[model samples]
Target: MALVELPYNQLVQWVIARGKTPEDCNKRLIAVEELCKGFFEKHTSIPQDVKDMQRHVHCEYTEWYEILCDITERLKSTEDGKKVNFIGQYSYEPLYDADKILRAFRKNNLHIVSYSQVLQKQMTFNLPFIKKGIESNNKELSDYKARRAESLRKLNANINELQNRLKVYCMDIKDYPFNEDFEVCLKTRLTQEIAIKNANMTIHNYHRTLKLVEALDNEVVPVFKAFVKYQKMDKNYHPEETMKHIRQAVKHGLEYATNGNEDTEERPSDDANAEPEEEPLIQIVKDDNELLVAEDKRRIIFSTQLGQSSFRQLLLGELLELLSFVKVRIDELQNRSNAANYIFSQSGENVNELIMQPISKYEKYIEVINEVIEILSGTDSMKALSILKNRSDLEKSAQGEISIWKRCCKEVAEQSDLDKRIQVTTETLKRFTSDLESARKTIKDTKAKLEKATAEVMGSPVKIFGEIDNI
Candidate 1:
């Protein structure tokens, strides 16, 4: 359901019905009412936010970081060359260079949150209320894939495909081959005058015949019938091509040996006391066109993941300015509230009116967000990549903080309710005690009256009995 603006009364009732006391409810009422009224609907890209960044960059703070310095330098550059084009008198922002760098990453599948998407996020968080739930609604495919892990079969398939691709990439790009070590011994021809050795691989003087022994390091390397290594001693030799062959051969040697034309079926154990056989690992290559894409996911996971973090950090930096503004405004309101409370306290009138105030925070609405992405730049892709790596941990921390906050609110409400119940119980006990005392006093007075009446009758009764005896 769409979240329309709820009235103050509705918010009050909503809070109160959830075990919150009226005083506590009033404290929360303002925030929820404002939310329902679209007070926070304005995106961080407002002119005020821009101005605040301008002001912050202009000021010289001792604690300014390296990234902040670069950003401020960009801002200061605005004063020098604020021109987009000579024909058009377009101006540059202090963050103009940074903005240019940010745009360069558009081809990256990173989400650049616009001012409008910020509003959409509000609705996105309400996904639990959506019709499709989480199976598939509007979440990006990349986001879904990033969060979920591949199944064992899929992962094995991917590993197999990657191994094959490496072999293909090496052999196809250059004349690099599956290089291996060969245990070779010289076969010498004992002639009458001169002795000659056979050429195993390297071309040598008086060496012609080449013979191959069993493949050396067969356990570690694939059991190839023959292996080739090309090495040019001339100035035309390329070290990069040579290194690629070496790296690929070493990395995928075991993989090729395990899967390349080997019997994969498990062998039956003949001896019971023999060492337990390990579970055989089999890899299946699937025909998936998705892997045919030009984008390299491995590179993205390691190095090319700047776009998302840059977008995130940029949005965060913008929001910090807005948060700083809100913090100041809230502080002013709090000071005013304190002054009003002090005035009320000075009045000596004895009254039992409840005067509970909600806990006043001087800093941020969500404190967890304050520590996120302090000062990120588009230039440092490494830093951005690092931020992307810790996405899961950051998510956990935020969710945990939110969960703790919800628990704390619920506890506060419960405590308030408990105090109220205890007070009512104490009052009932006092009234019962007072009534018991009054009843006791009345019982004592009636007993004294009965005693007096009995005594007076006794005093008269003695004479009556004497008169009867005389009669």
Candidate 2:
């Protein structure tokens, strides 16, 4: 029986088996079926009415049949044709209009064709080259997928391990936070927060990188492959041909490549009606460089602390509150020293000021805390943080756990990963202090104006917009 006479499904299976891997056989079969159905539907003249087709009176069917058969044979054939074992001994014979397959070969040298108009001037097609190119893309895509999966596995493992460690840490400290229902001290809380936040940030970075990788594999790469398939069909089909027009009509199609599914088919063009001067099919090699660049970009984003701004902001807020609490403690100590000095004076003895140095140090920290808040609220928290690191006290603290709270605060502030947050904190404080100074000036000016208005209005006794002392 002639190839055209074969059932559509059987023909698709035959074509797919010729060149496609068994893994993708089912997927390609579905694609071929959709392509064929779409082609037949559009070229109703070729298939004719069912009754007319059944009557075997129309010659259009023959042309259409030949085109389909040619496409199938081209898809299945190797560059240098060779006999291969199937269920039985079979050979791929180039069907009529085999020259149309040149389009497929043209796709392999897309970059060249795009660069050189001279090459595209000639109607040249190399089938074997196209086949090799497709195989190469498949292999690379496969390899990338493997690597991506491995990366995801490792990232997930790290995240899980960190989570487990955090869980254990929490359990260990759960009872250590207090004795006899006493409130947890800031040092203990700060210590736990610092450790937890560090782990959480690492996990966040891994998750973010993993997501980008998934996007490349699952979204970008598939789209790239679909474009290749479309180009393969584009060469043979003329943009003006009924089948091509039909395919293009449904360019945003429900079935086939239009659906944006990996399993969907590529769009087909009609070679017979295609313009001779039209550009040849070109394939864009899915660059491994693109993937590598994306990975590098991901690393940069996480490295600079830009990727998790929201989380860092929350942490800064916590630090600000803790610093405020520290300031209050300093104030209390200062008040106690003042009281002690007064008592010593009453006893006719002098006492050196205690806690004055610590109080002064904490006052400077309060200023830093204010600057950090200001930086976080600004447009460029990262830059602010980076610049603010110069004035940071986190790294200036004396080494060693002199006190539980001091150690925790020092560790948290000095942590390399948290340096960005400290910087942001200081910057925020600077901004807030500036705003506060400006507001103070504004308030002073307003008070002076109010007093002046009161004087002028009382002298006039009938002016509007002035506060009356009685009211």
Candidate 3:
């Protein structure tokens, strides 16, 4: 039998008349509307031009029409009472099978067949070989796992060494009387070493031998957990009781270190066989004084370190600001230079007049001096002082050469005996303007480049520290 094509509304009506439930018909209608709306959205803009003949529907429309047709034909052929079961049987069986296959593939096929066809092919021709391959793979995996376990053990050892070194360093620092300056120096050196060590780890990860170094850096938490577990196994203290003590110690240390106060009152101590009660650590008068002094020194050291860090940050910020200003000035100079160069290149009366010439030409020597001053001023005070001294020395040697050019231009103007002197003055002005413009551009571009390089250099440390904090 030939299937008759009907518009969507008629198809919906036919399905309803065939005795399917209103809910089923309504669902299909909603699907149709969504499909049509989505099709139009994908293929054509809203309020499309009537004159545009090439406008067409997208994939959703075709999909919806096919689905509706299939459903409608199924409804028409099935007995009225059995229509629902027929639809369910035909539509659901393949869908359920497909879903099962997908779930199975996701769970079991990590390294095996990646698709249905490949899975089928493997099962058909290579089932025995595949089983042997799995056994071989299992053996290799076991070997690799053993190697990884050994590597992890070595990594833990290295971390333990580093932790010991850190502990020793901290003890040494703690034993000494507090000096803010010395603390600052120690912190700076330690921080720099940390930075270099991190950089080396990143670069060294390229080699297989050094792969363990990267692993060592990453093994902190696992090793710490293992150490805690070992301590628990050794039963020096009950795991829960030991953890409580550690927590208490850390809390007391933070409080005493930050607030410079120690509770002198004593309470019950923990006994394995007896009931435990919370108590503060023992406090002595000398210990209180030492703790308070140490806390104060730490605060001072931190404040000084913070101040130095802030000062360096501010210096970089100022340098960046000066660089931005220099860039703007350079751009203005370049535009002026370009204009002057353009004027000189043109062939006309105005060209001879040298109109729009850079201001630098009339004051070439002065312009160069001003450029030197600007460049020097843009630097930090100490750097500026050095630059100024060097610039002064350079100016002395170049002054005579500059004067000769001035004399030559003046002599040419005098020989022309032109009444206006506008041409010569304008020409001279143009050259100076161009020089000023070029100098400005050079300074601006150089500053931007320097700022970019500095940002790139500092960015890595900031990012690394940020990641460590997050970790």
Candidate 4:
């Protein structure tokens, strides 16, 4: 049976209707079925759609394929052609029109072509040209490498020659001994010659020469002096004269004079049976025995002096320590005082209102007393004496009452109890007005006691005591 070609629209409708309904409803169903069967058979046997799509896709692909193949073939056919071979292989120049190719394929409903197949086709055309180019490049690269290697070898030879020359120069210089003056001079002259020969001699070379000279002065000179001294001492005869000779030699080298000519005086021969002259009393007094006794006395005196000096130093150290502690305490107290003063000043007529809840007058006094006690406890006897002296000076100062008033006022401001504050303030003001009459009396009593103690210690009256007692 011959197959008739149905339009896609009609075929789709017929297939849809056949799927939706039974054949008995329409008499044309049988004819439609018979036509459909023949149509399917022809379609399966010779798919015109598929063949058309293939033809369109193949045509489009062939254009690109032909161009790449032509370029590759042309490149491979020439001597310098391989350098351009990648134009066919990896190049995507043709694919620049990918959108057009895609549209054409879609218009024909063509099957999609693979990226690998496109690349393979490109490489197939490109390989021959690339191989030719690679061969030519490899030959040129080999020639260049050979030339580079030759140049490197020549450079290495020149470096080796220079190194050999340097080694010879070093050996020649090393042969000159530093101990021999002549060799040293020769080396010095050689160095000068080298420096003169070099037009670009640097400050660094001068510094190196100075360093060498310093080394000779520090190490070589001392060793040479010691060696000469040792040789002089090593001679068998004249043991006493040896020392004299060594001293003279050292003096000559150092450019100094000997102490005296006492060593040069002649002594009597050992075989002479002569009695020694009797020394005078003055001579006896100035003899080594007397000198030794005097030296012993001087040593005892020096030891006693050192002990007294050390005692004085110890006293000074203690005073310094006491002063430092007092200074710190005074600073702390002054800060608290200033703070209290500030609060009082700011309160202004309402000084009672400027109360700090946590801090109290008694507590502040305790703190101050504790600080004073710490300082007093840390102080040595010498510091106590120094403090007593300072207190004497402070007693003489007219500002003492003012200082006490200020301290008392600070204490008053810190008080929490109003009654106690008023009482303490009144008492403090009274004491200030009285200029510490009781404290002065107590200090007078202390002065008497200190005088008595000093008299007992020294077994004599101390003149300062009379002055303090009068105070």
CA RMSD per model (angstroms)? 49.2, 49.0, 44.0, 49.9
State the lDDT of candidate 3 residue by residue for 1-471, as single tens digits: 223333322332333354422424434344443543343334342222311322323321122222323333433344441333544643333223323333332232211111112223233333434345445545554554555455455545544444454453232323322233344444433333332232222212112212222232232212222333544553563433423322232222112222232342222122211321222212211322321112222232222211122322432343343334334334545666665345334344533343333444323323332332333233433232222224342233334323333333343344344323434444554555554454344334333332332233324211111111211
How many clashing pairs in candidate 2? 22
Provide the TM-score for each candidate, comma-separated: 0.19, 0.16, 0.15, 0.16
Return the top candidate by TM-score.
Answer: 1
Candidate 1 backbone overlaps, count: 2
User: Scored by CA lDDT, what does every candidate get?
Assistant: 0.29, 0.34, 0.32, 0.32
Candidate 1 lDDT, tens digit per residue, 1-471?
223233222332332354323434333333332332231133233334334444433322211122333443545455444556566533553344344433332222111111112223222332223223322322333343333223233434544443453342221212221111110100000110010000001111001100010111121111010111121232464333423322322232112122323222322122312322221112111143111111222122222212233333434443355345435435545667665344334323331011122324324232422432232232333332332234332233234323333343344445455556555555554554554454344334333332333233223211111111221
lDDT of 3: 0.32
Q: Report the error of model 4 at residue 223, Å.
A: 51
Ranking by TM-score: 1, 2, 4, 3
Query: Whole-model lDDT for model 4 versus the true structure?
Result: 0.32
For model 2, the stretches where C-alpha displacement exceeds 4 angstroms are 1-298, 303-306, 338-356, 382-471
Per-residue lDDT over 1-471 for candidate 2, one digit per residue giving the tens place of the 0 to 100 score: 111222211322333344322434334334443444444344343212221333322321121222444454543454333453575333433321133333332223221112121111111222223334445545554554555455455545544443454354343333333232322343333333333333233334333333333332332222223323444654663323312211221231222222222233432233312222322112111233111112322233333222345434543554454455556546565777676334323221211222223566556555654554444454444432322122222112211111332333333334433445445545555555554454344334433343333233224321112121111
Give Cα distance to truth, residue 116, candidate 4, Å.
13
**Which portions of model 1 miss their true places by more than 4 Å?**
1-397, 460-471
Candidate that beats the other on TM-score, 2 or 4, i.e. the better one: 2
Angstrom error at residue 377, model 4: 99
- Candidate 1, overall lDDT? 0.29
Q: Give candidate 3 regions above 4 Å deviation.
A: 1-126, 171-471
